[model samples]
Target: MTNMALSGHTFPSATLTCPNCQTTITYYDVSGSSYYGCPNCHAFFKYENEGPPEILTTFQPSTATPVLPIGSEGYLNGQFVRVVGLLHKKEAGSFYRWLEYMLLRQDGRYSQLAEYNGHWMVIEPTDHTYSHYHVGGKTYTINTDEGQYWLYNQYKPELLNAVGEFDWNCLEDEKLTISEYIRPPSMLISEQGATDSKWYKARYISRSELATAFGIAKDVLPAPSGVGAIEPADPDDRSGTLLAFTGMLLVAVFVLQVILSIVKPSTQLLKESYQTESDSSGTIKPIITSSFDVDGPTVLAFNLSASLDNQWIELPVTLINEQSGRVYEFSKTLEYYYGVEGGESWSEGSRDDDAVLSRIPSGRYHVNIYPARDLGKPVSFSIGITQNTMLGSNIALLLLLFSIYPISLFVNKQWHESQRWSNSDYSKVYTEEDKS
Candidate 1:
């Protein structure tokens, strides 16, 4: 009787007698497969020129089994591919290990499914040309005809074990160098051997996707660990959209400010200069301004300015309503200081300042100013009052509020990028120099 395994898709099989253990081996010589490691006897065989296969090597039988068994068929990438071979390899001088499944399509093209740390990737050969770039100081970039890529990893793989069939002799002890360059969710891999070089492109695949493709339970699959090398940091990043929104809001706020300024221009109510006066008994009398009428429901700006070399003046003032005898008391301080420090001009304190009283009702009012100076010298200052003034501070506050979210998004994006690159040798954050 012929032994066959079928799961929707089927493959033709042949039987070969293992010369070492004299046990019959069932192999799927699918798509020009020429090498096989006997499952029962653990002996490697190679077939050439339609002749009887010759034994290459033999090993103690292993108790381990592959996750995706040999001869299993899976629908992947819009095509049905058979898992014809499996190879277990580990990075030389490191504990990193991975499993590679050689997949054969009906048209005889080969692809690979690789798994590391529970992360999976579908790898396929590419024919496009590429250029290597190393701009020094931890910058390793690869420019392909397709796009740009950043160096992710470089390693040498030592084969640990193998089973099933392959296009080349899997038992050969050949040295190969592999390099991976990534562009997030996709990677470009270069394999260099003693004789030739080949390039392949690999895309990240999720465990759920693989389960659906192979008709397996997702819970039975390996759970993922840390972030994969080429996995997307933020698949739904919206930093650009947020920046555009912030820019639009800024323009809108500026236009609104201009419109408001033109509609209710500030009207100067009173402008006067005052000097402190003293009575015969040396009692200083407060200076008073002429009464002014204010329109209801508007902002009143009290502006004060003084000229001083390095002195300060304080004015305790009150807005008194002549009709109601009600007083609104406030105070202002003006200080100016400047000097040359270390051959550079430095200045602190302003010669001019203003305070605003908002929502003042319509009424006749007068200002009372009680002046005090740092020195006993007589202090002279100018005071101006304006109505319905539109403050630039309001617009500045709105701009800051609108910019906060976009700035936060930018910072978060940069942080995620740094985390993604943390595993790479060319990490922008923790570089090799930093590691050393």
Candidate 2:
């Protein structure tokens, strides 16, 4: 290939007349381009170093137009480039087809724009290489210097139609073997032939990017459908930020909970003992406690303790606000049963229980206690009330609430990844065992 530096409004050119179609064809790179495919009749011609060009073969003219037409100039990948060539390729054994647009810069560098199923990739030649190994009917490649890239596809592609110019005889009989390796938005491709080989690095590109860079209308670019091989799993740029935000929120809630627990310890409001005698008619009047003052909105803990000998008691309590006449009702059953069975001492229940009430406003409150116990025993229990008790469950609930977006982002990423590898031979989500 020639390395002549071109400037603004300067373009290399050569003109020739096609023998098959008698149509005049123009060449953009004089020293580099030796093959010309007639755009009108779809006939390919090869030009030697010092002779008249020879006819290679011909293909039926296609009705579909290239997205980036030949000779289109644009700023791409930080370079002013011209679309010098376009080749329509088909898989050797399949009906699948794609387009490859050759781009030439002023610095004599070449880049390729590959389009498949409306997805675009910017590919550039590279000097990197990798070693490959085959196992279980799959091919894998390892690049010791640049890390691992999984093999995606290996196939032979035939040139179905060609237009504009190329550096080599693209229609030559020597077959080419192409392999693709992918690592999500990045790809490494190897093109091996009988006498030469080439390596290319490709990164995914969006339709809007190309349209903006080339000053083309966005509607001219096809809309993408299924996930591309090298397409990013998550399109949202804020996924990482969201994940970090969730993690920081969890930490902040935990730290705040700990600080509040230390600085604002629980304050006992009331602690009193009540005695009840067993009554078969259940006519015992309830004991009412004195009014306790609650300063502001807070959480209240009601604690109960009792001494029993193989007996149980059900304590039903009602808290009434003196100012508003509002009532809160709850119940707890305290039991302590012990026995010697099989020469082992065993206990089944505890004699203490507690209940929590939240969001109580500033007011004076009193408790009405209703006690129900075993018919043959009398029970004595002490009741205690504490205010401003820090609850860990609140922090847990906050963490769960804050995790919704991050978890949904993760699920969306996995779903996109699964879609990307759905048609791949070496799928990461589905193994051979799963298929069986």
Candidate 3:
């Protein structure tokens, strides 16, 4: 293969007559030596060292028309380029077929535009050589051999059709070995053959972007199917951000709760004793406590202590606002029992119970207590009321409610990750035991 700089040329186009079909063809050779295929006869020819053209084999004409046709001019990578040639190639052992458009700048620089299943990628030859690459801070090994197990497969792509002019002798059924390393939606491709080894950096291109670059309509391009090797990672995925936000909200709520518990001093409103006799019927006389002023949103807790032997006591209490007649009702139950079972003494229930009312408004309030006793037993109980008491259950419920958003975001992120890795050769669900 001849490598010549095609820049600084002063030729329009070279006219040649094909020796086989006698078809007259006009071709451009900015690279000093180039290949040309007859548009009508589809005969391949090569010219080297600016000499006369030599006839190669004739290939079949392609039925497929490219979105960017040969001889079409466009601006790519800040340079005006013309689509000079097109090669439709397919994998040797697979049904995978792709199109490669050869782009030639006026200054003789060459690049390739590849399309596979409506996915577009632009590959430019790079002067940099490397056995490994650091992409996004992660190191990836490069595979050079044609046959071995690797992260990516080695392909011997056979040329199916050719049109227009190419720098190299583009022939049909000619197979070239290529090795690729991919970090989607970017890839590094190494072309190795009898000629010099070539490296290229490939980046994914969206249909819209390709259309705009080539001055074509977006609908004219085919829609992409499966995920492409160089398809970009979605930047709009904000799962990590949402999880962080939820985590911070949880921490803030916990810190606020702790600060409120330490800073706000609870005020004892009422502490009184009430008794219910065994003969008491229906409803006992309500014990009214002295009125206390509640100045802010506060928690009103009532602690009831009772003495009962193997019996239960129920108390219904109401806190009534004197100014607005607003009423808050709560219930507490007390029971204690002791017995010997299996030669072990055990006690069940407790002699004390408590109830809490949260976020009560500011006002003057008094308590009314009604007591009920079981089995005609007398019960003596004391009631204690305090404001601004912390409710642990309420805090726990709030935390649980706030966690729903993060949990949902996490599940969605996991699903997206699974989709991204579905094409990988290595999977998380596979294990050595399962393989065995």
Query: Which of the numbered candidates is closest to the native, going by highest lDDT?
Result: 2
Q: Regarding TM-score, does 2 or 3 come out ahead?
A: 2
Compared with the true structure, model 1 gives a TM-score of 0.73
Return the lDDT, model 1, position 386.
95
- Candidate 3 TM-score, C-alpha based: 0.67
* lDDT (Cα) of model 2: 0.81
Model 2 lDDT tens row, 1-436: 2223443442665577777777877666777778889998888888758577788888877655688888788887788888888988888888778898988876787898999989899999988766666544354754645566778877898888899888888875228888898886889998888988888899998888889878999899888979998888765566888877877887887788778778766799999998885347776658899899986688999999988889998899999999999998999999999999999999999999989999989899999998888865678899999998877677667877887777888898888888887767674433466445
- Which of 1 and 3 is the better model by lDDT? 1
- Write model 1 residue lDDT over 1-436, tens digit each, in one string: 2254434454667666666776766666544767877777777877655677788887665534467887778898888888877887778898788889988765568889998878899999999646778755666778766677888788888776677778787644237788898887899998888887888999988888899888888987788787787766554556667777888888887787688678877799999998776779876778889999988668888989887668888888899889989888889888888999899998899888889887888899999998877756666789999998876677678878887877787677667677767776674322567535
The pairs that clash in candidate 1 are: none
User: Which residue pairs does candidate 3 place in steric collision?
Assistant: 185-230, 185-231
lDDT of 1 at 410: 69
| Rank ordering of all candidates by lDDT, starting from the highest | 2, 1, 3
TM-score of each: 0.73, 0.83, 0.67
What candidate 2 gets wrong by more than 4 Å, as runs, is 1-10, 133-139, 144-146, 172-174, 270-280, 303-315, 331-355, 372-384, 429-436
